[model samples]
Target: MKRIGLTGGIGSGKSTVASLLVAEGAVLVDTDAIARSIAQTGGIAMPAIEAAFGSSVIAPDGSLDRVAMRQLVFTDAGAKTRLEAILHPLIGTETQRQAAAAGDHAVVVFDVPLLVESGRWRTLVDRVLVVDAREETQLQRVMSRSGWAPEAVRAVIAQQAPRKARRAAADAVIYNESLTLAELGTEVRGLWKLWAAATTR
Candidate 1:
């Protein structure tokens, strides 16, 4: 499998690009989905999460209390580390399982949001595809999508690697700024052809 690590800052339309790739036959290993699965009720990581963060971090319905945990990790570095410790391994395991189960494919895109910040995923993937947009664009997109305040969007951005850093880490980049869906589809098709050809050889 030719592993492509896909990442972008919040609201950069990474998911849009990922969907386009999937439509073009790329196997997707979505880390965010894996994380959500592991945080669901009776998930593999739930026991560890509860043990680390206490039952208060679990909702009354038995799932992770995402809001509470998000708040904790936002304010506390130690809490962030603890949360990563619980979720990363589970996500990694599931990622591997999904990747292994995929057929002979030219591209298997690992849609990981923090690929740049993790400082480890770059070496694992055959190529890194950074879906990019301007900071102001990102902030506005996130606010509109999530109904978050400007400061909330900024806070999330602050925790991420800078745009320059993401660009530097990228082997490929899709400038997702102001492109219509049809335009984006054309761009993704071009990339899929390029990557699929390169990987098959």
Candidate 2:
């Protein structure tokens, strides 16, 4: 089994790459999706979140108040650390279980947003596939798709590992600079063949 760590900064078109890989038969274990699920209303991490951040960070429907939490974490490192403490362990456990369930001879893709930051993930994956794009492109895509203010998007970007660092960490890099959808698909297919070869051998 080949566990490939797929990562990119926010608004870097990572999901598109992940979808293309999925279409090519790679089993995806998306950590962001797992985190969202666990933080939703009545989710596995709710009790701990409510206990740590209190009802202030929980919505009326009982879901985690993403806006509130996001604001807090951006300004308060302690709050972010505390939240990560509560969620990272659960996400890791679930990710491992899902990857194991994917079985032998399968290429398990761990779609993680912070794969570069988490040294643990580097050791776990056979290869690191970084989806790359320029900051200006990322800001435009994020603002258009998310309806987020440019400042907000920039703030998020500022918190992530920079473009150069991510590029430095990649085993293979997929550059998203001005590439059309067809081109991107072609790139993914080519990479899939390489990863598939690794698993089959």
Candidate 3:
């Protein structure tokens, strides 16, 4: 099996790329989804979170109040680190389990939004595929899609590794700027062929 780490900064179309790859037969494991599941009210990470941040982060419907939690973590570095500490291990365990369950022939794409920040998981994969776009495009996309103000979007970006740093760490880069879905799919297909040949050899 080829364990590929797919990553990008917020609003870089990482999910879109991952979706296309999934449609084309890649076994997709999304870390963000796993983290969300873990953080849900009464979920695995909730007890620790409620203990650390108090009950205000939980909603009436037994779900984590994402907006409230986000505000708390974004403002407090320690809170953010503590949350990551709780969730990262669970996400890593589930991701590895899913990858292992995928047969030897499987081409697994682990869609990790914070692949760079969560440095421990990088070595678990055979290759890093970075979905990249211009910084301005990223800001615009995030603001429009998330309804975050420009400053908020920039703050989120600030917490991520800069584009140059991420590109330097990447084994492969998919330039998403000015590309249509079909064009992106073509690129992914080419990469798949390369991966198939490399892993087979």
Candidate 4:
């Protein structure tokens, strides 16, 4: 299988491009979804999370209290490191398992929002496909879609890798800032054709 590392900044329309790839029959391994699954109630990572952060970060129903954890991590620099240590390995293992299970000729796209920051994904995939957009475009899209304040959207954007860095890491980039859905799909299909053709060679 050929593996593609798909990534983008928040609100860059990475998910939309991912769906387009799926429509082209790409097998997707969404790391964010896996992370959420592992942090949910009765999840594999819950016990370790409880051990690391204690019961305060756990909801009454036993799931990770995302709001509480987010607040804690924001206040404590070490808290984010601790959380990543717990989560990254599990996410990586599951991600690899899914990719390995793909058909021999399949094009497996790993949709990782943090692929640039992770420091390891670049080495794992055959190519990196970054979904790109201007920072102001990202801020507006996030605010409109999520109903978040501008500052709140900016704060989230601040935590992600910079546009230049993500573009530098990309084997290909889809500039998504001003494109309509149809245009975006067309772009993704063109790239998917290239990747799909490469898999056969």
> Which candidate gets the maximum lDDT versus the true structure?
2
TM-scores of the candidates are: 0.96, 0.98, 0.94, 0.95
Ranking by TM-score: 2, 1, 4, 3
lDDT of 3 at 48: 80
Candidate 1 Cα RMSD (Å): 1.1
For model 1, what is the alpha-carbon lDDT of residue 68?
92
- Pull out the clashing pairs in model 4: none
lDDT (Cα, tens digit) per residue for candidate 2, span 1-201: 888999999888899999999999989999999999999988999999999999999999999999999999999999999999999999999998999999997888999999888778889989999999999999999999989999999999999999998989999999988889999999999999987887656
User: Candidate 1's residue-wise lDDT over 112-183, tens digit each?
Assistant: 999999999988999999999999999999998889899889989999999999999998889999999999
Instruction: State in Å the error of residue 162, model 4.
Output: 0.5
> All models: lDDT?
0.92, 0.93, 0.87, 0.92
Order by lDDT, highest first = 2, 4, 1, 3
* TM-score of structure candidate 2: 0.98
Residue ranges of candidate 3 with Cα displaced over 4 Å:
none
Tens-digit per-residue lDDT, 82-139, candidate 4? 9999999999899889888897878899999999998989998999999999999998
Pitting candidate 1 against candidate 3, the one with the higher TM-score is: 1
